[model samples]
Target chain A: MKNALQTVLALLGEDYDSILQAWLETQKAEGVRRPDLFSDRESRRQLGDILRGLGEGISRSDLSEGIALDADSWTDLRATLDEVTQERVERGVSPSEMATFILAMKQPVFARLRERLAADPTRLIEEITQFSRVVDALAMHTNEHFIEARDQVIERQRAEMMELSTPVVQLWDRVLTIPLIGTLDSMRAQEVMENLLNAIVEHSAEVVIVDITGVRVVDTQVAQHLLRTAAAVRLMGAEAIISGISPKIAQTMVELGVDVGEVTTRPTIRAALAHAFRRVGFSIEKVENARG
Target chain B: MADTASVYLVEHVLLVAIPDNITDTEIMSLQEELSTRIVSDGARGVVIDIAALEIVDTFVGRVLAQLSSMARLLAAETFVVGMRPAVAMTLVELGMDLHGSRTALTLSHALRALRSEGLA
Candidate 1:
């Protein structure tokens, strides 16, 4: 096993360029190349770097003990693939497409080993299995990194969207308004409370109108989050008026037994604003005008 | 433990700023001191400013609620002021209601709310 692996490593070190060229040909023939999504030059460079790094990692690796690539010994290989995965994820490349690209190198490397080790069938089988395992391990590592990078991208966008969605506005001298949209989770609830409280202090707001017309459902968890926000607002000495409770939501709230004690609820933002104005000692009267 | 919370009179209202590093014993003594000051000085309102505090465990929460109820017995309104949003959320999550005690965003707002309602 050791001698067969040494022979394969020797071949890779000696004829690295030819195997890499064969792999590129296989990749192109397999239609893994997508020029429409990005420039082919950049993708080719990433693949080339990853192959070179993988070759170096395998040559120095001790495959006699096990086929798994030790993370510390394969730092360069991991770094190269990490860059490729990050770029591919940013370009919206599907995981299957990435898998296909990484898997295409297997056939070319296998063919090279066959040509060199076909004299000994048993050794050929052992070396081929070891080489295949190494390739498989690298592919799996790249795939895992691809998914992690994609998740990080999504997590970042979610955070940015949360900040964009929760905007605290001041409707009057002592009134603050937060028009909620989409689902309300615990983290978002915390964000809402923080933003509202900061706005209250910033504006010295006495009344806060939390409009939930954009919210589609009010489940028990969502109700609890809303109630917590209201309680936090009250702790700040500002009245929290939950507005725009559709009939559907009101029914859901009752079914859920979500009691919003002392937190005023209104049917619409307009009504809530009026109530807030009244609470802050303001009243709006209709104006009568004559044409001049 | 090093320094206790001090209750002072500001505009005929008791101003109790609970320091962040106060010990449990200090908290009790501070509550007693507030009671004594509220009665002897004839304070119309009591504002407990806790904005600098990061956590209000169940014990501290109960003390604040007790202080409010106790102030009512002395004919003085209790307004907990400057509660951080995070602290308020945690208190709710911990199932502590502060028992219907009045809360304000700042010292000034606490004073204004009490004055507007004729409690201060």
Candidate 2:
């Protein structure tokens, strides 16, 4: 019998128990003696027949009328069951399991009720009570499963986002140079911001050079991300030197009406480095010698 | 609303052939649907065929990241397929991280990679 109960519970998903519990409460409110339904085999059999009929497409209205269960009360019970089942389905529980659970609860309750039919043929109170207990258990289990599934999804999403945002390298005492090797989409922009800020603070970077020589093109959105990164660096009291302004990117910037005049740009990383050195009051004599 | 396209399953891996112009809403819906299927059936991995995509924006990148995490949660792996050179260049220029996230040059290659990793 316990195995049967477990089987039924597994099949019903989660809300079946809750629906049964609510029906029992409704029966009790109407002065029905519910406990005797489980003790009697005839009453149990009758309950089973009714549940089988319900499963076979007998409406809850018809079941209530046939069993002397209040029509209005049964309607409320059906609504609650529907609500619970929908909730379970939305949470990714299979519908077949839910149906099986409902059928399982009906079996024991109806079997007990069938036994009681000989003593008091109209007594459905005990059957309703038993159904109520089983349904409550099912509902609790279903709700727990739903919550577990939801949490698993949320946790996975959080972890994945974290992985995506994971910094490629940590900043030490040296002025780390991160070459912007590809397109500057918003997602990568946010990542660059976080990484650069952390590196600056950790290493107390005197100058951070972002070389975009490898970038093939620049759009307005990408430009905005760069500006935002520069602003973020300034807030951290560090200098951001953007180098490798390809002629194509420059043309796009102008065409897109983006004014990056305030952003210090250089033809290459070497030029940006020279500018950085000059800012620190040190002239690169090698470049001067080459020019000489 | 477009019809929910059928997912192609092969050797425990689910392949979703997404159109080039995938919207954010579509990505979100796909994420939800794929997550449900993966959990219910316990798939080995998922490969998103992006061969048709000419350009990828930030939203798409975020969605891929989300999908990767969702697949991991289901004990499945995720891979992007058919990354065009031009699109790849754009992603790099835009500062998108393509490294460490599983990627393949073709759908068949992605599947093979997953199989090699014992995920498919």
The model with the greatest TM-score is 1
Q: For candidate 2, what is the DockQ?
A: 0.01
TM-score for each prediction?
A: 0.75, 0.32
The Cα RMSD of model 2 versus the native structure comes to 25.7
Question: Model 1 - which docking category?
Answer: medium
What's the residue-level lDDT of A246 in candidate 1?
92
Q: How do the residues A1-292 of candidate 2 rate in per-residue lDDT, one tens digit apiece?
A: 2222332233333444443554444444443323432333432443344343333222323332233332453444444454555444454544444444444555444554555444754445544554455455444544555566557667888777655543434222334466776566677777777777666656656467777786656888888777767655543435677888878888888999988645678878888877777654566454544642
| Model 1 steric clash pairs | A236-B104, A236-B105, A237-B104
Per-residue C-alpha lDDT of model 1 across residues A139-169, encoded as one tens digit per residue:
8987999999988999999889999889998
Indicate which candidate wins on lDDT: 1
lDDT of 2 by residue, B30-103 (tens): 88888988877778898887768777887787787678877887888888766554455456456654332466
| Candidate 1 lDDT, B1-120, residue by residue in tens | 325676778778988888887778899988888889988999989999998888889899989899999998998888898887678777877877676588877888788877887766
